[model samples]
Target: MAKMVDQNPLKFSKYIKTYYGISFVEFLNRLKIHYFLTHVDHVDQFTLETYIYQSGFANRSTFYVAFKKYVGVNPSFYLKELKGK
Candidate 1:
């Protein structure tokens, strides 16, 4: 089995901010929403986790912290809002 490489979420976030003119957390929120919309067939947690992992979040705890900071709510709640939109 191949070992998975660990990603540095903060570094990746910095890059996003440097190039995108948006805060890292904002970029992450947008990514989460985009992922949900693109893969609407998936359940909320699945989409959120997939985006969190794919976007170089160090782990679930970090993802949750950053997500809450940017989104003003938890990932689940954010997903619920998206559904209502």
Candidate 2:
């Protein structure tokens, strides 16, 4: 997700130090958001299942759980909102 900040230097940099006291799980959640938004256009469960498998998540269920916890919404909902935009 480093590329997300590289492309939006100012906006991302603002949060660089804000995660200092956060938990590792929270950090992972942040990365998940960046990953989701950056890859929203290419997302497909079969593909994501392959990609996220290596991230220590056994399956989409776990990933979605953490994703919803931090994002306050499911990826499908986020995608729907983006489409409306």
Candidate 3:
């Protein structure tokens, strides 16, 4: 899709930033984070760390940051909140 618009990734990323008010990386990160949130529970995980990597986050910190940014809480807090409900 990006190629159809601009052959250069840098230019296409710039256009995404110009229009979306965020860098393309942010856009992709948010999408990945949301996908993780929706599917994280349904998927079997032998370890939380494994799930984090499988969800497309490079590491736990990156996942935590994105989770906090979008969900307004870190994963641990979010899990606690879920338990309270």
**Alpha-carbon lDDT, every model:** 0.65, 0.65, 0.79
Q: Which lDDT tens digits does candidate 2 get at residues 1-85?
A: 4575475644454465465656545676667656665666655555767555645566788778887887789867876887787
Model 1: which ten-residue window has the lowest total lDDT?
Answer: 1-10
**Cα deviation in Å at residue 15, candidate 3?**
2.2
How would the candidate models be sorted by lDDT, starting from the highest?
Answer: 3, 2, 1
**Model 2 deviation from native, Cα RMSD in Å:** 7.9
Model 1, stretches more than 4 Å misplaced? 1-47
Residue runs of model 2 more than 4 Å from their true location after superposition? 1-19, 44-56
Give the lDDT of residue 5 in candidate 3. Answer: 69
Residue 42 in candidate 2, Cα distance off native in Å: 1.8
| TM-score list, all predictions | 0.45, 0.52, 0.77
Q: lDDT for model 2, on a 0 to 1 scale?
A: 0.65
- Residue-wise lDDT of candidate 1 within 8-39, one digit each (tens)? 76766666779998986677556765554465
Q: What is the Cα-based lDDT of residue 31 in candidate 1?
A: 73
Tens-digit lDDT track of model 3 for 1-85:
4778656888888888998889887887888888777875654446768778877889999888888887888888876766566
Worst 10 residues of 3 by lDDT: 39-48
